[model samples]
Target: MIEIQNRAGVERARVTGRVVGNMLQALRTRCRVGTNLLEIDEWARLMILEAGARSCYVDYAPGFGRGPFGHVICTAVNDAVLHGRPRDLRLADGDLLTLDLAVIVDGIAADAAISFIVGAVRDPEDMRMIETTERALAAAIEIAAPGARLGDLSHAIGEVLAGAGYPINLEFGGHGIGSTMHQGPHVANDGRPGRGYRLRPGLLLALEPWVMADTDRLVTDPDDGWTLRSATGCRTAHTEHTIAITETGAEILTLPGR
Candidate 1:
């Protein structure tokens, strides 16, 4: 369901968004070589609980994923893109990691994701992929204000990814988010500017732009039934943020502590 938040609802969303942002930031800071993926999930769980927030992932049972995600955050490494269930894998010196998280505060939910390299080792390709997704996300946000069509945002993101020479995947993309984790008006990475839903005030959308280095196709991991990997096993990166549409412009709610 698509939800348009009122002033009060927006306030609640802001609070939830901050919680999610802070948790992701903290996790990002503590992540490094030798750190286990499950440990990152545990750290996120503790932070969410400390903030008195509810995890949107743990206990999440969506049709696309195996029931009950049972984790607070997604730890996607290298070839893994979305719905990456935390496991017992440890990070290496140059592992490209992505953390995707969502939480609810005062009944409002916010979602965001970040990708980075572990223990820094000059990998130009990895840095480029990470930077491209972030740029795409920023582009989408720049065009996300009242009167802008959903396609405008998608096209803005798509241009960056496509121009960067990465393949775009449509199976999983951004979505409307407020009061729940996922909602309607699916926002694909690539689209025509004049098509689809129109932007309006108080509508919160999780704008994510992800890409596989070599292919647009994805293959679900057989072991966990949740993780989405590049069909060709190529590297990937994803970036996302929750934004609220407003009267004059768009407000990025998922920014870390001012």
Candidate 2:
């Protein structure tokens, strides 16, 4: 279902987006070597409660995943990418970790993700992967203006990933988000321009661009039934931001710190 927030609803969406962005930033800063995934989840829970917000993932139980996510945040390390269920493992230095979060505030929802190295040792490949996804996300956002077609955004994202020599995966991508966590107008990471749904004012979209280092294939973790890892065990990275379409252009609601 696609939702176009009214003026008042858009105001609420901005609040939710800001909260989501701040929470994710705090989580990123707190994550480091020796940090346990479970601890991170707990931190998320605390932050959400403190903000008087609601988690969109805690009770998520899509067909592919196990019943009830039962966690506050997604902590994907190294090879793990999307839907990363928090575990007991502690992060190690140089481990690439991706934190994906979605939450609702004042009846509006916003989603975002960020990937970064856990500690000091800067692996060139890991940094490159992270940079690639970030650039792709920026490109996609730049093209997400009112009246712009969804394909334009997807094409912009694909150009960055392809130019950076990373394979694009279509299995999962961005989507419309508002009152609910996930909604329609599926935004793929790669697509032909001038196609797909046209953008309009008051529309909200969570634009994410993720890629694996070597291949586009993914393998779901059997134990937890939530973490999605690279089939080739290659390091991966993801970058996302929730945006709202306005009369003139796009407003990036999930940008941290103004």
Q: In model 1, which runs have C-alpha deviations exceeding 4 angstroms? A: none
TM-score of 1: 0.98
Model 2, 1-258: lDDT tens digits are 999989998999999999989988888888879999999999999999999999999889999997899998898998999999998899999899999999999899999999998888577988888998999988888777887999999999999999999999999999999889999989999999999999999999999999999999999999998899999999999999999999988889998885
> What are the runs in model 2 whose C-alpha is more than 4 Å off?
none
- Distance from true location, Cα of 140 in model 2, Å: 1.2
Give the TM-score of each candidate. 0.98, 0.98
The C-alpha RMSD of each candidate to the native structure, in angstroms, is 0.8, 0.8
Report the C-alpha displacement of residue 223, candidate 2, in angstroms.
0.6
Clashing pairs in 2: none
Give the whole-model CA lDDT for all candidates, comma-separated. 0.92, 0.92
How good is model 2 by TM-score? 0.98
The stretch of ten residues in a row with the least summed lDDT in candidate 1 is 115-124
